[model samples]
Target: MSHYPVHTMATAPEASQPSLHALQSAFGFIPNIAGAMATSPVLSSSLVGLFGNVHGGSFTEPQIQVLLLTNAVTNEAEWAVAFHTTLALQQGLTPADVDAIRSARLPNDPAFAALSRLARTLIEKRGRLDVTDSAAFLQAGFTEEDLLEVIAVTAASTITNYTANVTKPPLEPAFRDHAWHPA
Candidate 1:
């Protein structure tokens, strides 16, 4: 296979020194995806900001992981699925929680599980959330705002997953142990 190009801030016009250095400082090395995104600093920065907002949203880390893993699974984006699964684990999601979300089953929390199902459905169906699904989400104790946040999380992951696939960014060493394998 042809190797994907390694993007450097020096070579990618859209990158600035501070942004590049910030990434280097955070990760101890700039991620390949961040490097490729150097081709469009605006895109990279916006994505970072958006995801930060989503991460800061009311949903717990494992809840976010359920949505991400569901999307990645539906999209057949193995890399994203693996990476986010690892993220869930790192954030203290139980093995059962991981398996539940990965299998598209809701754990004991029917409402959240329903929310997970709804996220996967919206992704698979391209934004056509059913009325009952909306009701289910509401019943699950998520507000309209949380639903919007769910969409945001899904959209954010879609962007990164596609970027990583297209750029073939090298998986960070920390993530390599969890490198993708198709389910």
Candidate 2:
């Protein structure tokens, strides 16, 4: 069992309530990871703000999901893996592509393949991307701006991925069908 409480809006600390409510409004429910993060008002609120910026940035929702799912897999965060798996499919990523990401392979679509590879490389290399690392993404048709946005997406997922790893929150029902384990 998780030591961290999966706080609801009512049960969360005062500073965390707004962040919880924002998350609830965005997702139509507060994710268990977010609930756990609420235990730290700073974390919960920081995530809420960064979440907005990341989602509102240049990438499409499906593209964002691709990066998030990749990061979750690389981080080996079970809750985030399941959560992003569900979101990835809902955002129209094919099962084959999602499976590829979950299996630590690139997707069939070149753009998504670029995203997955970049995210995995970023995590594996700890943000130390050499020229060849960056050239591959640029070769895939993504701009320098998209590369930076990928970093933003990675940053957001890191918060959730690390939080989920630490909190060990229960997977929600909606995401349960996509449950994952590190290979």
The superposed Cα distance between candidate 1 and the true structure at residue 122, in angstroms, equals: 1.4
Give the poorly placed runs of model 1, Cα more than 4 Å off. 8-29, 107-112
Q: Report the lDDT tens digits of candidate 2 across residue range 1-183.
A: 889999998899999999999999999999999999999999998999889999999999999999999999999999999999998999999999999999999999999999999999999999999999999999999999999888888888999999999999999998889999997
Question: Which of the numbered candidates is closest to the native, going by highest TM-score?
Answer: 2
lDDT of each: 0.72, 0.94
Which residue pairs clash within candidate 1? none
Q: Give the clashing residue pairs of candidate 2, or none.
A: none
Worst 10 residues of 1 by lDDT: 1-10
